[model samples]
Target: METNEVFEKVKGLFVEDLGIDESKVTMDAKLEEDLEIDSLGIVEVVMAFEDEFDIEIDDEELADVSTVGQAVNLLHSKI
Candidate 1:
């Protein structure tokens, strides 16, 4: 998948599942700091991504992914 496609799908996941404003779901937006997603919410987001992309994301793989761009890059790489 293209980087932009990954970004858009991840952005949609954030907006739909987390109720985040699309305008604030920028490439640099921090998942915890900017989006205020708690630990449980993070798990939910991860699961949602796994379902949406039909890919598996282990916890270790997500340990350092704190930003939207980072998550997009990870997903892109997996695809």
Candidate 2:
């Protein structure tokens, strides 16, 4: 999938998993500060991404994914 499409799907996961407003889950949004996603929340998001993309995300990569755009780009590369 394209990066933009992956971004939108990740945004949906943020909404579903975190109860975040869809409007606020933009590409540049910081997962922790903007979306209030804690470490556990990050784990949940990673798991959701793994399921959605059918790819495994390692801990080091997950640590580096601090922004929505980063997640999009990472998923894009994997896809």
Across 1-79, the per-residue lDDT of candidate 1 in tens digits comes to 8999999999998898778989999999999999989898899999999999999999999988999999999999999
Question: lDDT of candidate 2 vs native?
Answer: 0.85
lDDT of 1: 0.92
TM-score of model number 1: 0.95
Per lDDT, the best of the predicted structures is: 1
The lDDT for every candidate, in the order shown, is 0.92, 0.85
**TM-score of candidate 2 versus the correct structure, residues matched by position:** 0.91
Query: Which candidate should be chosen as best, given TM-score against the real structure?
Result: 1
- lDDT of candidate 2 over 1-79, digit per residue (tens): 7777888788878788768898888889998998888988887888888998899989988768888888899899998
Q: Candidate 1 regions off by >4 Å?
A: none
TM-score for all models, in order of appearance: 0.95, 0.91
Residue clash pairs of candidate 1: none
Error of 1 at 78 (Å): 0.5
User: Could you tell me which residue pairs clash in candidate 2?
Assistant: none
